[model samples]
Target: MKKLFTLTILFFSLVAAAQTEDATSSEINENATFQRWAIDVGAGVHKPTRPFVDGYVSTPDLWQADLGVRYMFTRSFGVGLEFGYNNIQSDADASVTFESDYYRVGLEGIVNLGDFVNLKSASSRFGILGHGGIGVGFLTSNARTLTDATDHHLNFTAGIAPQYRVTKNIAVFTDLTIIGTTRNHYGWDGAVLGTEVRGFEGLMINASVGLTFYLGEGTDPADFAQDPIEAKVDAIAAQMEKMAIENADDDQDGVPNYLDRDNTTESGVRVDSKGRAIDMNKNGIPDDMESSLNARYASQSDVQTAINSANAANQNQIKQLINEGYVNVYFRFNSTKPTTYSLGAINTIVQYMKDHPSATATLTGFADEIGSPEYNKSLSERRAKMVSDVLAAAGIDASRLTQNGDGEDASVDKNSTDARQLVRRVTFKVN
Candidate 1:
C-alpha cells in the first residue's frame, strides 16, 4: 500500500509538470468547449528498470503486456492514470520463472500540436497534432518463489503522440513512449544458482502504437471560428492598400491628396492641368491649374515631377479618419431631398456636434440658372434652408449654421447641364 501511494504521488507530479495547450479558436463555442475532456485507453509491452531483484524464477519467460486508461482535460491537452500486469522470465537452470501482476494509477499530461505538429483541435475538421505526458504507478507480485517477492514502488514514463483529426470530435493517434521504473525486478535473486540473472531489472525503453476515439463534450462542433492570425494579418494589409488609393495626391507633389489645397486644379495657381504641384504660373499657387497665368513654385519640393506618382499611403492616416468623427454624404440627381442613406451622415454630424459643441457649419446652396436669376436665387435659398432644417432636427444648434445661396451663378461646367447641376448643390463646410 505504501508503494501504491508513492506511485500515485509520482504520477501526479508528472502530470502537473506537463504543458497545457493554448486556446486555438478566437471565440468560445459551447460544443467545442466540451471537447476539453477526453478519455484514452491503450495496451503495450513493458520492460522493468531495476537491478538485483528478479520477478522471474530460473528459466522463466521474459516479457509482459500493460493496459490503462487516461482522461483529457482539454482536446489539446489531457492527463491519464492507468495500471498493468507484467511477466518476467529466467534462463534454463531448470530454475523456474516467476510471474506476477502490478496495480498502478499514474497521472499523464498530454498536448496536441495540430497536423503539422502533434495534436488537433475539434474546430478543424482535419488537422495534425502532437501530445506528450509523464505517468507513475505501483507494482507488487503474488508469486510463491522465495525470490519472487513484490514491494511498493513507482514507475516514471514519458511519451510523444502524433495524431490526425478525422473529424472535429474524433481522431486517430499514434505514440512512442520511454518508460522507467524505481526498483529492480528483473536481475538475479537468492534463488539464482548462476553468476548472473539473464533477465533485466529496472531500465528505460520505447514502444509505439496507434489509437482512435472521441474526445468528449468539450470538443463540440461550434468551438471553432474564422479567426486565424494569418487571416487577420492579411485583412490589415488589404485595408492599408485601400488607404493608399484614397490618399494618393491626384496632383503629384510632395504633399498628399488629403493636404492638397486645391483638390481639382483645373485653374488654380497651386496646381497644374493634371492636378499636380508646379510653379509654372509664376504665382504662389501650383502652375498646373493656373496654366502659366500666375503662381510660381515656392520650392523644388512643390514641383510635380511625375504625373503618375504612386506612393504608399500611411495606415495611421486612415485609422485617424476612423478615430476622428467623419461624415460622407452622397446626393441624388438635381434633387434637394435628403434620402434615407443620408441619415448615416447626419448621425456622424450629430456625434461631432456632441463631441465639439463649439463647432460651426456654413450651409451654402447653389442651383443651375436655366431659369431666371430671380427664380434660381429663391430656389437656392430654399435648398439651403432645407439643409439647415435637417441639421437643426439632428440636434445642431440653429444659431451655429451660417446659410448662403448661390443662384445658378457659379457652375462647375459652363458647357454641360449635368456638370452645372452637380455644382448646384448644398455643401456644409465645417469650421
Candidate 2:
C-alpha cells in the first residue's frame, strides 16, 4: 500500500507537469481556458454491503477517506488517480461476523456531464462529475468463523462527485461511490454452507466530502467557466484590461504617452494645450526649446541631451496624432486582411474622425522586402486600399481619406523581425 501510494504521487506529479506544459498550444487559436488541473482530497463513510457471503447482515457503519488528483485534457474528459483507506465493521447474517480494513487505489476516467448539458447557469456555483476505475485492494482482516490474515485483491470503483465551487482556487466536493473487491477465498471455506458465492467478495459504498484545489498559471474563475456568455464576457474583459494597460499614462498626465505630445513633463507641472511643458520664465517659448538653445550656447556635450529631449517630444507628438487623432492598421505577410487585434485601433480612428468632422487622414502602407518588388508593391497597395474601405464603411468620407503604398522602399529592416513588423503596417496621418 505504501509503495502504491508513492507510485500514485509520482504519477500525478508527472501528469501535473505535462498539464502545465501542454496547457497552451500554439496550433489552437482559442484562449487557454480549456487547460485545467485539480487535486481533490475528501473523507466519507464506507458501508460494506456484504463481506464474504450474499446474506451477510449490515455492521455498524464503516468509514473511508481518500485523496485524488486529476488533469482535464479537455473541458469534458479527464483522468485521475485516487488512494484512500476503508474500515469495515464486523457483522453477520445467520452464520459469521466479518470485519476488514483495506487500502484502496484506482485510476479513473472522469466525465463532466455539465459540459454537455446546460445545467449550469452563467454564474452557477456548482458542478457534477462522474468517474470510475479499477486497481489493487489490500485488505487486512480477521473473520471469527472464516479466517484471520491479510489479503490483496483486484478492486473496481465508480463514483459521482458533486462539487461546489467556492472560489477560483478552492471547491468543496462530496463523492458517492461503490467499490467491489475480488472474492476472499481463504476466509470463505465454511463460513456459510448455503450462502451463494459470487465471484467478488466485498461490496462497499463510500461517501466522502473533500476540497479540490485548481492549479497552474490560469487560475481565474473565468479560465474554467463553461457558460458561453460568461466565457465571452471574461474574454472581452481581459482584452479591455489589456488595452487599458497598453494605453495607460504612466506619468499620470492627462494625455497618455501613446497620445501625449510631450511625455517628459513632470507630475503636477503645468503644460500647454499641446502637452509641452510651459516656459514660466521665457517669453512663451516652450521649456524644451529654451533648454536646447541654452545648451547649444553653453557646450556641444549638453547639446546632445537637449537634442534628445526635443526628439522625444517630437516623437510623442507624432504618436499622439497616430494613436489618438488617427489610427493604424496592421497586416499579415502577403495578405491584405487586417488583424483582428487591431479592431480597437480602427475604432479609435473612427471615433476621432467623428469628433472632428473636418479632419482628413492620409493612409500609407508599406511592406517588408521579402518578396519581389512588384509583388510587394501590389500587396502594400491592396493593404492601403483595404484600410481606406474600412474607414469609408465606418462613415468616414472617402474624399477626406487618401491612401498610398510605399512598398519595400519603406522597409525598416529586411532581416530583423522587430524592425520588419513596422514595415507591414498601414499608418495614417491627420491632414
Candidate 3:
C-alpha cells in the first residue's frame, strides 16, 4: 500500500513537470489514442504473499489471466471493468497439495500520465498509466471440498501499465499489479488470517502483457498538428523582412548612400537603369523633351528647332500653372529629398512667387500606403519641411512658405509600384 501511494505521487509529478510547446505530429496522434474505446486480453504470472494458507505449504505455479474493456473520457482519465482468473498453487511436498482458483470482476479508474503532461520530444512513443480498483474475489481451494471452505472476499487492486504505441489503433502493454484479498479458512486452526499479514488481508504480485485494440473511430490526428507548409511560408516571409531590414543588394545600383553605388566598373561613368553608360542623346528621355536640352543638340540646327518647340510647350504648361495658382511636386517612397524630376516643378513655383511678391504658397505633404499612420504623419511633416527648406534656399521668403502634412489621409492607386509612388508627394496652393 505504501508502494502504491509512492508510485501514484511519482506519476502525477512526472505529468506536471513534462509540459512543453514542441509536441510533434506523431505525439499529437498518440495523444489522440486515449479518446478510443478499447478491448484487451492478457495472461501472466501472479506471486502470492501468504507463505501458508492452512499450514506451511510452499506455493508454486502461480498464474493469472484477464479480459477487459475500457472507455476514455479524455486523454488523461478513463474507466474500465474486467474479469480475471487466478490460481495459487502449492508445492508437492505440502499436505493435500493446496490449490486455490480465484475468480473476480472489478471496476478501475485509470490515468494516462504521459499524454497528460505532453512532453516535447518528437520521437517519444512510450505511455505510462496508473490504475486502482475494487471487486469481489471468490476463493475455491482443493481443501474447499466442503461448503464452508468456499468463500467470497473483497479484492483491492492497484497497478502500473507501461505501453508502447505501435500505431493509432494498436499498442502492446505490460500491467504489473498488487492484488489483495483474504482466504476464509486460514491456518491449521481454521481461523481467518487478519490484516497484520502484508497490509490489506493478503497480497499477490500479478504481471501480464497484452494487445490492446482501439474499437471505435477516435479523434482525427490532423486537427491539432502543425502545418509544415504554412510554417515554411511564415519562415520565408520573416527572412524576407529581415533582408529588407538589412538592405540586401546584389548589385549596388538602388538608392540612399550604400545602395546608390553604380554597378559599372568605371568610377565616374553615369549608368542608365540597366547599368550601361548613359548615351547623351539616346537615353530613354528624348532630347526634345529634356529640361536643359542637352548641349550636344547645340551642334545640330534641327535638334535646336525641336528644343525650341519643346520650350514653347513648357511655357504653355507654365501659363496653365500660373492660371491655376500652383503646381504639385512628387517624391519617391518614404523620402523627404526631392528628385530632379520634381525640382523643375518646385522652380516653377519659386518663379511664380517671385513674379507676385504678395503670393504665399502652402506645401502639404503626403505618404504612401506602406507605413503606419503616426509614422506616415511624421514622415509627411518632414517632407513638407524639406520642401519649405528648399524654397527658402531658393531665395523665397521664409514668411511666404507654409507647410502641412496630410499623412495617409488621401486615397491613391496602390495596386502597383508605380501607382503607390504617386502617393508619396507634396502638393501646393498659392494664395
Task: Put down candidate 3 lDDT per residue, 1-431, tens digits, no spaces.
Answer: 56654554554444333232214344433444333477778888877765354644344344789987876554555667888988776656666455677788887766665654553144345677777776777767664463467556666778888777677667788998887764444532223454324445556678999877777664422111223444467689999887685564333434323344434212233455544435476533322333322321222334335334645766444444533523456665567877555665677778768867888878888887777889999989899999999999999999998998998845655554444555677877777
TM-score of each: 0.37, 0.44, 0.44
Give a tens-digit lDDT track for model 2, residues 271-326: 76656657776443344444533432322234335434645666444335463423
> Residue 321 CA error for candidate 3 (Å)?
50
For all candidates, the clash counts are 61, 1, 0
For model 2, the stretches where C-alpha displacement exceeds 4 angstroms are 1-31, 53-60, 91-98, 142-148, 186-201, 221-224, 227-431
Which stretches of candidate 1 lie above 4 Å from their native place?
1-34, 49-76, 90-96, 113-149, 165-170, 183-201, 204-210, 218-431
Candidate with best lDDT: 2
Q: How does model 3 fare in lDDT?
A: 0.61
Better of 1 and 2 by lDDT: 2
Candidate numbers, best lDDT first, in rank order: 2, 3, 1
Give every collision pair in model 3: none
Pairs in steric clash, model 2: 44-208
